[model samples]
Target: MLTPTDVLKDKVAVIYGGAGSLGAGVARAYTDAGARVFLAGRTEDTLRKASAEVGAEYDVVDALDEAAVEAHAGAVVERAGRIDISFNLVPRGDLQGIPLTEMSVDDYTRPVVQGLSCQFITARAAARRMVAQGGGVILSLDSGSRHGTPMLGGTGAADGAMDALIRQLAQELGPSGVRALGIWTAGVADTLTPEKLAGAGAPAMDEAALQGVLAHLDSLRMTKRSPRIADIAALATFLASDAASSITGTWINATAGMFPS
Candidate 1:
C-alpha cells in the first residue's frame, strides 16, 4: 500500500486557483505527500499565504486567460522539468437561490461559460505538455449539481458541461499517456462559510437556519454527514498519484452518496 507520506514523492503538481479554501487544503495534502507543489491564482497575497502554510511555491496566473495559463504551464515545466499533475479548483462565479424563471439569460449562462472556458484553458495547456512528456494526470472538480439540484441556477448546467468535457478529454488524451478525471463533491461543510454562501446569492442564514441547512444535506447522504475538506484533499492526492493509474475519464463521487453512480 502507498502511504500518504510519500505517494507523490518528487512529483510536480500545479494547481490553478490554489489560494481558495479547497485548493489550499489540497495543496497542503499534496505537499505532505511529498509533491513539489506550485500554487497559482490571480491574487498574489493569498497565494503567498497558502504557499507559506504548505511550503509550496506560488505564482500569479489567471486560469481563464489562455495565454497566461499556457505561459504558466511552460514556466512550471521550466522549473520542475515536468508537470505530473494539474488540478483546477477555480471558482465558477455562479449565482444561486434564484429560480430560472426569475433569472436573466446571462445569469443562467455565466457559470457554464466560465466553467468550460477555464477548464479548457488550463487542461489543454497541461495536456500538451503531458503529451510531450509521455504521461500525466489532469483533475477537475464540480458540485455534482447536474443531477437536478433545483434553485442552483446555472450550476447544474455548468457541471454537466464539465462532465462532458472531462469524458471527452480523457478519450482523446488517454492514448498519449495522459489521463483526465474529475471529482463530484458538494456541501462540504468546511468549504461553506456564511460569506461564501451569501456571495453565491443565497439569503443570509442565522445560526439555527444554517444548522438546519447542514442537517438537510446530511439527511440526503447515505453517510448522514457531508465530506469535509480533508476528505476531499486525501482523495485528490490519491487520484493524482501513481496508485490510481488506472482511473481516468470519470468523475469520482465524493458527495457522500448524495448522488450515487
Candidate 2:
C-alpha cells in the first residue's frame, strides 16, 4: 500500500494563487505528498517566497486573464510534461456586512462575476490540457455562503454559481477522465485578521470584535472549533491525489459541519 507521502508520487500540480495563506499551505502539502508543485499568482515576491519554502517552481500569472491563464497552463505542461492537478484559490472580491437591499447592483454582483469568470478561465485552461493528457483533478474553493448567511453581500450568489459550474464541469469532463470539484469553507482561523478581513471588503473591526467573530464561527461548527489552514491543506491533498479518484462532481464540505449537505 502507498504511504501518505507517496499518494501523489510523480504528479505535477499547478496552484493558482499559490502565494496566499491557504494556497501556500496546500502547496506545501502537495509537495510533501510527492507532487511537483508550480505556484502561480499575480505577486512575484510572495510567489517566490512560497515557492522557495516548498522547493516548488514559481510564476506570475493573473488567474482572471484568459490569455495569461492559458499561456501559463501551456508553459506548465511544457515544463512538467502534464498537469495532474489544477487548483484555483483565487480571492474573489466579496463585500460583506451590507444588506442586499442597501447595496448597489455592482456591489451585489462583483463576487459573482469575478469569482465565476476567473474560475472558468483557469478551469478551462486546465480542463483542455487534462482532456488531452488522459486524467486530472480540477479543484476550487469558496466560502460556504450558499447556506444564506445574512449580510454576506454577494458571497452566497457567487458561491452558488461556482457550485453549479463545478457540477457542470464534472458532468462534461468526466468522460474525458477529468474530475472537477471544490471545497466549501469560510472564516478560516489563521487567515482571519482585521487587515485581511477589511481587505476582502468586510466591515472593519477592532481586535476584540474580530475575536468575537472567530468565536461565533467556532460556535457554529459541530466541532466547536474553527478550521485552520492545515485542515484545508490536508483535505486538498487527499482530493488531489489518485486516492480520491472516486470523489468528484461536488463540494466536499470542509465547513467543519457548519451545515449539512
Candidate 3:
C-alpha cells in the first residue's frame, strides 16, 4: 500500500505548543500523515490531551530553552530513530495594548525576545539533527506580522523578526540539506476563545466589527474567506513533506486572502 501517507511513515516530527488550538490541529494533521509527532508545551494536561488525540507523545518544555530543546530533539531522534520535521509555534507574551508611541521598551522587546529565542533554539536543535540526517523541514508559524498589521503592536514586530530568521536559517541550512519556510496566518476565529481573546486584549470587535474585518480581509484576498486551522495544518504538513522540499526561504500565505506579499 504505497501512498503519500507512507511518505512520513518513519519520519519524526516535533511540534511546540501542540496543546494550543492551532497546534493541536497541526499535530493531528501531521499524525494522520504518518509522522511520529512529539507534542511539547507548558502544560502536561493540555499536552497529554493533545497527544492522545493525535496519538503522539507529549513533553513539557520551554521552547526558548536551548538546552532543553536540544535534549528534546535528541530524545526524539533516539526514540523515533530520526528527526524529520519541526514546527515552533510558541506564543509570545504580546498583550501590550498601548499604541506604538506609548508602548514601553520592555513591552516591545518582550515578545521579540521570547519569539525569536524560541524559534532559534528549537530550529537550531532540529537543524543539527536534520542536517546530520542529510535534510529536513522546519516551519515557524505566526508570521502574519511579516506583511504588517496596524492593530498588532508587538506581534507584527515579533513576526517580522521571525520571518527574517526563517529566511536566514533557510539560506544557511540549505547547503546542509535542511529547508526552512514559514506560513503567515492571522485571526483564526476557531483558535480565538473568549478567554484567550480577553486575556490578549484582542480587538473587542462585535459581530459586525468582526464581519467587517473578514470582509476587509476578503476584499484584499484572491479568496473570500480566511483559512481554517485544518487548511493551514494541511499545507504545513505538505510543506514538511517532500512535496514542498524546494520551498525553502519563502513565506507562504495560508491567510486565505488578507496578506499579499
Candidate 4:
C-alpha cells in the first residue's frame, strides 16, 4: 500500500490545460505526491510559470489539435517512459446567462463541440500509449450540469456528452487496464470573480453583487461552502493513485453536496 506522503511516487502525469488555475493546483498536488508532472497548453508563458512553480516540464500543445496532442503524448513517453495519469482541464468556451429561447444554434453548440473534441483528442492520445504500457488513468473536470439547469446555455449539453463519453471509454478500456473518470464541481470559490462571471456571459457586477452571487452558490451546497482549488486538487491526487483502483467509469461528485449522488 502507498503512504499518504508518496502516493504517486515515480508516477508520470500529463495535464492538459495545465496553465489554468485549477490545472496548476492539481499539478502542484501531484508533484507533492511524488509524481513527475508535465504541463501541456497553448500558452508557453503561463505553462512555463506553472511548470516552474511545480518543478514540472512544460509543453506548448493545444488540446483541441489532434496532431499536437499526439505529438505531445509521444514526447512525454519518450522522456518519462510511461504516462501514469492524464487529466483534461480544458475550458469549454461555454456562454451562459442566456435563455434557450434567445440562444443561437452556435451558442448552444459551441461548448458541446469544443469540449468533446478536446477531451476526446487528449484522452485518446494518452489511452493509446497507456494501453501499450499495460494500464493508466484518464481524468476530466466538468460542471455536472446535466440536471437540466436553466440559463446555462450549452453547459448542460456539453456535460452530458462528456459524461457519456467517459462511461463509454471506461467500458472499452477497462479490459486494457485503463480507467476513465471525472470530477463534477462548479462555482469554485477561488476561481470566481466578477470579471470571470461577465466573461461567461453573465451580467457585470460589483464586489457586493459578486459576494451575493458567491453566497447564493454556497447556499446551494449541502456543506454551505464552495469547493476550493485545493479541495479539487487533493481529490485528483487520490483518484490518480492506486488507492482508487476500484474507481472508474463515472464522475466523483466534488461539488460539496451541491447535487446528490
Candidate 5:
C-alpha cells in the first residue's frame, strides 16, 4: 500500500541543486514518486532543462544567500501550497585529495563554512515553513565521515558538522512533525567527471579512476558493489515519506557495501 508513488502523492518537494547530475537523478526519482517537484540552481537554462525531464517547475536560486533562499522557499510554498520535502544538494566545492600539509587554509575552510551555512539557511527556512504547516521532511547528502579520511581535505569536517546539526534539528523539530535526515554517498559512476571534480579543486577524476575507487569501496561493502544514484534516491524517497516516521536523527548510509557498519 505504501509504494513510493503513494508515499509522495500530491506532495511538494524542493531540490536546491536540482540541475546537477546527482540532484537531477534525485529530482527525477522524486517526480516519479508523485510529488510536484521544484528544481532550483544557479543556471536558469540547466534548471529549465532538468526540470523538463521531471515535469517539475524550474527556478533560479542561490542557496548560499539566506535571503535569496528564503524568497525562493516562499515562492515554492506559494505555488505548491506547502513544502513537503526540502533537499539541499548544493555543491560544497570541497578541496581535493591534497595532502593536509599541501592544502591551503582557504581551501579547507571555504567548504566547511559554505556547507554549514547553506544547510543552516535552507533547513531553517524549510523547518519554519513545515512547522507552520504541520509536517515535512528535510534531506541532505554527505560523505558520513564515519572513517576519518585523512586526505578528504575538510570534507569529513564539513560533513561531520552537518551531521551534528541534523541530529539536533531532528530532536527540536520531531515534536513539531518535521523530520531531518541525511545520506552519505561517495561514489556514483554516472556523476563522476573530470570537470565536476575540478570544480571542487580536484585535478580530474575520470570514469576509470572513479570506478576503480568504487570497486575498492565495493570490496569493502557488504554487497561488494558501489551503489548507484537510484539506490540513494530510493532510500531518500522512503526517508521523505511516512514510512521513516520513526527514523529521525540517524545517519543512514545508502552505500551498497562500502562503509558498512
Candidate 6:
C-alpha cells in the first residue's frame, strides 16, 4: 500500500504542456509525491522555468507534433527506464463567448481538431511504452463543458471529443495494463486573468466583472467556491498514483459539483 509520502517514489512522469499554470501545479505535486517528472512543451524558456521550480527535467516538444511527442516519450523511457505516468495539459486553441451562429467555421473546428489530435498523439506515444513496461497511467484534463455550455464556441465539441477518447482508450488499453482517465474541471480561479481570457477570445473582464463571473460560477456549483489550482493538482497526483489503479475508463469530476456524476 502506498502512503501519503513516496506515493510515486522512483516513478517517471511525463507532463505535456508542463509550462502552463495548471501544468506547473501538477508537476510540482508529482515531484512532491516523489516522481521524477519530465516537463514537455514547445516553449523552452517557460519549460525551463517550470522545471526549475519543480526540480524536474524539461523537454521542448510540441504535443501536437506526432514526431516530437513520440521522440520525447522514447527519450523519457530511454533515460528513466520506464514511463509510469503521462499527463496531457496542452491547451486547445478554443475561442469562447461567441454563439455558434456568429462563430466562424475555423473557430468552431479549431479546438475540436487540435484537442483530439494532441490528445491522441501524446496518449498513444505513452501507451506504447507503458504497455511494454507492464502498466502505467495516462491522464487528461478537460473543462467538463460538454454537457451543454452555451456561448463557448467549440469548447463542448472539443471537450466531448476528449472525454470520448479517454473512455475508449481506457477500454482498449486496460487489458494491456494501461489505465486511461481524465479530470473535469473548469473556471479555475487562479487561471482566469484578463489577459488569458482575451487570449481565449473572451472579453477581458475588469476586476469587478471577473469577481462577478466567478461568483456566478460558484453559485452554480454545489460547493460555493471554484476549484483552485492546488485542488486540481492534488487530485491529479493521487489519480496518478498506484492507489488509483482500479479507477479508469471515466473522468473524475473536479468541477465543484457543477455537474452531477
Instruction: Give the per-residue lDDT digits (tens) of candidate 2, residues 175-230.
Output: 99999999988767988888888976667799999999899989999999988999
Off by over 4 Å in 6: none
- After superposing all C-alphas onto the true structure, candidate 1 shows an RMSD in angstroms of 1.2
TM-score of each: 0.97, 0.97, 0.91, 0.97, 0.93, 0.97
Misplaced by over 4 Å in model 5 are: 205-211
Supply candidate 6's per-residue lDDT for 64: 89
Q: What is the C-alpha local distance difference test score of candidate 3?
A: 0.82
lDDT of 1 by residue, 1-261 (tens): 767799999899999999999899999999999999999999999999999998899999989999999998999999999999999999888999999999999988999999899999999999999999999999999989887788999999999999999999999999998999999987688788778888889788887877788888889998999999999999999999998999999999999998887
What is the alpha-carbon lDDT of model 6 when measured against the actual structure?
0.91
For residue 219, give model 6's deviation from the true position in Å.
Answer: 1.8
Question: Scored by CA lDDT, what does every candidate get?
Answer: 0.92, 0.91, 0.82, 0.92, 0.84, 0.91
lDDT of 4 by residue, 1-261 (tens): 767769999999999989988899999999999999999999999998999998889999989989989988999999999999999998888999899999999989999999999999999999999999999999998988877788999998899999998999999999999999999997678888888788889898999999999999999999999999999999999999999999999999988888777
Worst 10 residues of 3 by lDDT: 189-198
Model 2 off-target regions past 4 Å?
none
Enumerate clash totals for all models, in the order shown. Answer: 0, 0, 1, 0, 2, 0
